[model samples]
Target: MTTNPYDDIAEWYDDRVRSAWGHPGDESDLLAMLTGLTGDVDGLDICDLGCGQGIVSRRFARMGARVVGVDISSRLLAIAAREESANPLGVEYVNDDAQSLSRLSGGSFDGVVCTWSMADIEDLDSCYRSVERILRPGGWFVFLITHPCFQGPGSRWVGAERVVVDYFAEGFWRSENPDGVRGKVGAHHRTLSTYLNGLVEAGLSLERLVEPCGIAPINASLPDTSKVPVFLAVRSRKT
Candidate 1:
């Protein structure tokens, strides 16, 4: 049977994942970066690719953009739907695979936003291709993912030094943290080259790459601003 990490914590994933950082739109860094690349978001048709629970979608919708949120997790979609109903911001939530966002019309979206989901994708090439197909020329695709260098489930803390196994390796990975609640259920690890090459192969041009650090909620409590680079934010455009 295929494992679903979100399913295990479906009931609490929202609070845990959402609160893992401070505030709801802590992911606004990606949005800010994207808007910096494209400028102005009003009336834009935005697709929240792999949008879990519609947090980012809600933010975009509030900005007067037409937001369509797509994800594979039914549980997460349920949460997203609830938010949409309450907010009535015209955000549409669809249960769909990231690699094939066929349910959405082609060349329709002005921007595609994804958060913390790229590493979990098994077929990234297909995902990028689908993004290219769905976005109009010059449309932007922004994404946040785990930093391939320092973060993952296989990381071990031996004394004060941390050890990472297969940090450079790519392909499916499965590792369980001691807490069990946090785990790498299954994922594809790729280098910067892989993602850049995939974008080029999909006829997209890389515009910006960000390695965000010390942005987590816990970081605010820490005196020192060093643990790891926990996130990678990327912006690409269909050409």
Candidate 2:
């Protein structure tokens, strides 16, 4: 797949990823964090960047926020639309690259969220800047992504240390699926510092950082899963 498989994988995308994320402990941790982060969304204006299949997007709408979900893939947007209609949580959908949240009105949102999508973006600086532009001063920008400190392209999951090969830099990562070869998946990698600096450059202040050990059955056996963080959730405020 040269291009993003989201367009073609829309049908089965939800099932596959959902199964992986829906692990009992995984879901609980995410839900608990989200519930705590967003206690009462009675009238907040929220935007979900790269809101795949409207998972978190719809959830926010259900919390009584006026939600807008944006994505680059039409296929994912289609599925998100279907989900919006079926659930009818009043979530609005937009098809656009997350790097350009400027398409929306300035200072239009109280909270902006990006989940599991930052890794796929080529320009983290632009994306953070755009998010800052769309959010009101003091508004929150919550981002969830794969932990870059441990996971990177071609980094084998061999028990503990995710031995990364020649990918010690912060940029694009390429991996081969057929084997542990490089340059196959066109994977990208960025150091955690790059992301933090990007947010600071965008005029956002870091509030909290969380590395969630997903609530999957395998978590019980994998020592690395508990010792090392797998996913990161960053909370920031547009200042």
Candidate 3:
């Protein structure tokens, strides 16, 4: 069986990769951004696409939303299930690809959230289509991804803490993981226009854009992020 990259690193991700997804005040945190976008989500039916280890899904449940966490990796779902069992947050976990949520019916969710996984998804356009199909009209699709303009495998630090990045370079790129979530992980990069266009093509209206930094938590080691954004979070409506 081909091993899923996320599955290989699920155990260490909470402590290692979690911060990369952002937190309450860290800016690019999709959960925090979603809360700000849709106030009072109590009783909302939410689907967490690409929900690795169910961290955000549990958070959504805590916010009084009925949450279902979905991912392509069984290993990650297993870890999420373990966490859910321990806490009993009433979050459902599913093992499935984000691009093909065939088990779910159309117009089923009130909102959807995906964080720190867009760059890694091979068929993001398909995922967007699925998200649009599953979300009711006016439902929100919130997501966060590494800022393609300033953060990627093509980025390098230079003198005076300057950043050299390839804004136009696009494709799969691999880099060594400093957090040991894995020795290496592959992330696909596309232009900012490409990301925005994908949503437009999928019938989602861009509502808000935020470039958040993880400076407070990671600036000591990744100082470049303090100067530039680490991630881009978007809130789109399926209207």
Candidate 4:
């Protein structure tokens, strides 16, 4: 079996995520955008793809959805399962890669959500295909990712302005700054078009797009991020 890159840093990453959630003033808009896109998931069967530590999955379960959180990292899933056991939200955590989702049944979900995890996935096309396969007819797929244009390889914040280099450079890249998540796990960089086109190819139609402006709590190193959009959220429907 292939070793999960997140297994070693699972505990550290969970702590960082929890700390970020505690700071109300530094909250990220991705979750808000997700809520707006997926209004009232009450009693809906929702899948939280690439769910780490059950953060977003718990929210969905609390909203009355039968949530199944899938992730590749066993360590992260352990944390998620432990939290579920303590809180009893009825969330089921499954250890599976987003690219395949071999454990999940096809057309079994009312909606699928991937928040801030698309970049971490290596095979964008395969992941999108899995998302499409898992959703019921007309089921929505909502996702939020770092703005690829401004957050790609060699991109950084200089003073109050954002500097972007190699925007067209696609593939795996890691940030030099060790404090950031990208610096730790690295990410697959793809153009905005690549994401949209890939979705279309996977039989998911783009329904809505949101470029939210706010400084993500995790992006402390990128100052003045509010001046520009830091995250891109999209709502797509299976066709």
Which stretch of 10 consecutive residues in model 1 shows the poorest summed lDDT?
216-225
Summing lDDT over every window of 10 consecutive residues in candidate 3, give the lowest-scoring window: 23-32
| Model 2, residue pairs in steric clash | 25-215, 26-215, 173-187, 173-188, 175-184
Candidate 3 lDDT, 131-179, residue by residue in tens: 9999999899988776777766546556536464666778887655564
Query: lDDT tens string, model 1, 1-239?
Result: 12356765666768865665445556545456545555577899999987878877887887789999988888888888987776588998888888888688899999998877888778999999999999999999888776666555476555545567766687776656643333535667777788789998998889888875555453454333355565578888999
Pairs that collide, model 4: none
What is the C-alpha local distance difference test score of each model? 0.75, 0.75, 0.77, 0.88
Give the TM-score comparing model 3 with the true structure, all chains together. 0.87
> Which regions of candidate 3 are displaced past 4 Å?
1-3, 17-31, 159-162, 176-183, 213-215, 218-220
Model 1 misplacement above 4 A:
1-5, 22-39, 157-162, 178-184, 218-227
Better of 1 and 4 by lDDT: 4
Clash totals, every prediction: 0, 5, 0, 0
Could you say which candidate leads in TM-score? 4
Residue lDDT tens for model 4, 1-239: 33478898999989987887653223355566688998889999999998999899988887899999999889999999998888899999888889999999999999999888999898999999999999999999999898898899999888888899999999999998897789999999999999999999999999999887664555566576668888889999998
For candidate 1, the per-residue lDDT at 211 reads 72
- Give the local distance difference test score of model 1: 0.75
